[model samples]
Target: MIRVRGTVGAWPVDLQIELDDQDWAALARQASAEPATTAAAAARPSGDDPLWSRAQALLREAGELEGPELLAALAALAGSDQAGKRLLVRLRHCDQVEIVQRGEAPLYRWIAQ
Candidate 1:
């Protein structure tokens, strides 16, 4: 059994999950059988991911930036648009970041907490 308690936005979250022996075995197998590349890429914790750090640093230094401009910068930093989008999504959900729409465009602003 696993229990998770936290808050999401304005709501509280309480979650409980149970797994039987077979489920545990299957999960262990899947975890151990993960592709080498995927496992290697995630060898470090998410907080230690260089790209994530760089993305946050970029936003911090910029203070505020337009969505498209930030995307282009992140793309350059990440070497691909798709990776940039992934970083953008991370930033969107980050508590320190606030997004404001100005005439159909979102402005990403960093608010240090």
Candidate 2:
């Protein structure tokens, strides 16, 4: 189970997602296959869900962003560096995103359909 609460515009947003063991297994399988997960990720609309869904929205909106920039955005949204890093790692493993070396930092690019 995961919980996230924040604001989108002037509206308050709160989200909680609970995945069963079977769902976890399926999600794990989907994660291993880039194409399948990428497609699944896109199907989820970015509403007010502040957990994994919002993390996806951030990367997708940024398109291509530097590590620091992405980190800062996540921190601002998630409220702490540690929380931000957790989301960052989750985003990193998502199929729609690719992290590459830009200079000394990594550039996160959102792969579009």
Candidate 3:
């Protein structure tokens, strides 16, 4: 069984799709067949931009969020000289920080200490 959830306006909806073992196995095999290449993997940033690094560390530590949400959050935070306003907004919504914006930009410091 597969369960999916999404929101419409202010309401939330869920859907469940059930499959037999054979069908499940086929789906798993299909997924496993398409592995990301090394260059594609390496295109992701690996660095000390605090927000990107912190977000990555948090994701690793929490082991939650996947697919587009994960990608959007990561892309929002990554590959910038500093974490900007939009990334700050995303991070704040995730409860990752208490942010302060100066004009159109974000100035990030550690959340508490």
Candidate 4:
């Protein structure tokens, strides 16, 4: 099962899609068939200024947000999990942000202007 929460045409959407074992296996096989180098080449950031600017804006606007929500939003903005993770790592090193343990998930808090 996969849960998706986002906006579609200015309307907020939250939904879940469930896949059978066969479907899961097919997805796994398809992922494994992809070449690592191809994925790596695609993962490389191209002029990251826009992405970073948007990221900082999101951090400032959110003030404080749960980790999973932040990840999902970042992934949505970035268009890929790899890119989202990269953004999260970059945010982690920023002086204006802080991530702290909060129960099972971390919380992202903006600490500077």
Best by TM-score: 1
Model 4, 1-113: lDDT tens per residue?
99999999999999999999999999999899988888998876555689988987898898987888888888889999988888888888788998899799998999996
Q: Give the TM-score of candidate 3.
A: 0.30
Off by over 4 Å in 4: 1-48
Give the Cα lDDT of each candidate.
0.92, 0.84, 0.58, 0.88
For model 3, give the 10-residue run with minimal summed lDDT. 104-113
What's the TM-score of every candidate structure? 0.61, 0.54, 0.30, 0.56
Ranking by lDDT: 1, 4, 2, 3
Over 4-111, each residue of candidate 3 has an lDDT whose tens digit, in order, gives 999889899898999999998998897777666765667654455577566746555545543335445556656542444345455556454544555654443344
Error of 2 at 2 (Å): 35
Most lDDT-accurate candidate: 1
**22-63 per-residue lDDT for model 1 (tens digits):** 999999899889977898878634777888999999999999
Off by over 4 Å in 2: 1-49
lDDT of 1: 0.92
Q: Name the better of 3 and 4 by lDDT.
A: 4
Query: Considering summed lDDT, which 10 consecutive residues are worst modelled in model 2?
Result: 43-52
